[model samples]
Target: MPVEPDPTRRSHESWRAILDATFELLEEGGYESVTMGAIAARAGVGRQTLYRWWPSKAAVVFEVFLDKTNIGPFLAGGEDFPTQLRAFAHGFRTLYVEGPAGTRLRELTGAAQTDPDLARAMAEQWFEPRRAPVRQALQEAQKAGVVRIDIAPDTALDLVFAPMHYRLLVSGGPVDAEYVDAIVDLALAALAPGATPA
Candidate 1:
């Protein structure tokens, strides 16, 4: 069902209205319930308007999450990679592992397993851009001799963050600071130059 949205909203206001309406529909039901017609009706925008900006329903839904979600890890990288990594991990915890967004993530993850468009849209529109800064930070650390060059930054990110995703999606484990620290500790130690085998 389309929620009541200000039909008069336009331009940037229309954009916000579109996203807001998408979020409302998501809350009212779930991923399955959100449709282009409902979104257009709710936002008082034409279906073409949504298509003008985003390719699909999943794309529009992802946009709402991106728009509402916090801009993560204020300090992109730091002199202390460990500290930076901790903050980054915590940022992920807060954004994708903890609350409403986290719940959406878990839901969409399962949803994506079936809907190829959603899978592709989530990865391309949502995950790819966000991963860049963190990857750049890792690359810089590697160049600075702070991180081992042998491991790719992408792989490092996966290693550092996979457990958080696992906890949120698979294991249903706690993603507290302690768990983050444990993952960081093990990951950094492995990624340290001249590191010894345990």
Candidate 2:
């Protein structure tokens, strides 16, 4: 009798292939060029297999972005609020502002403006997962009195991350180490207890 193969292992391999192919296409040609059929061909998987795992090309690209970046580990680094915030900010900048990933992200964001479905999928699949660790870190900071207890964790996250996004997506400013440190510093100052309006 022939030995049975592990479905779980096969599934993981297929998923990896799909993501790798998606990233390669994104790096080579941005979002508009990355079609489901191309991804399937490059990944050596069926188009149906791609559809079975994801709803659209946008979804696959966002998932690939998340997989490639792996923001969780960076957000989880360091013990204190400032340290963790710095690490997360730097990691975010590296992933979204320094390379091909940045260009792909900007392309997707532009597309999301007209495509509500893609917008929702990106928020659910990419934004939420990336935000969770930062939210948790904020909660911990609040509990430890490092961050103001008055503000919601989500708001705190916005304070910390929104400027980076604005710089990357809208302002066209440099997102270098100095900028990251300044953003983290200002955010922390605002979140500190008894902080005053500047």
Task: Point to the candidate with the largest TM-score.
Answer: 1
Tens-place lDDT per residue, model 2, 147-172, is 88988788887886888888888888
In order of appearance, the predictions have TM-scores of 0.76, 0.74
Candidates' C-alpha lDDT: 0.78, 0.78
- How many pairs in model 1 have backbone atoms within 3 A of each other, for residues 3 or more apart or on separate chains, i.e. clashes? 0
Off-target runs (Cα >4 Å) in candidate 2 are 1-23, 35-56, 66-69, 76-78
lDDT per residue as tens, model 1, 1-198:
112234564377788888889999999998889999999999998998888777778667766776676555434544577777777787777776556887777777777887898898778756776677778888888999988998778888898888888778788888888888899898988889987556
Choose the strongest candidate by lDDT: 2
lDDT of 1: 0.78
lDDT at residue 98 of model 2 (Cα atoms): 66
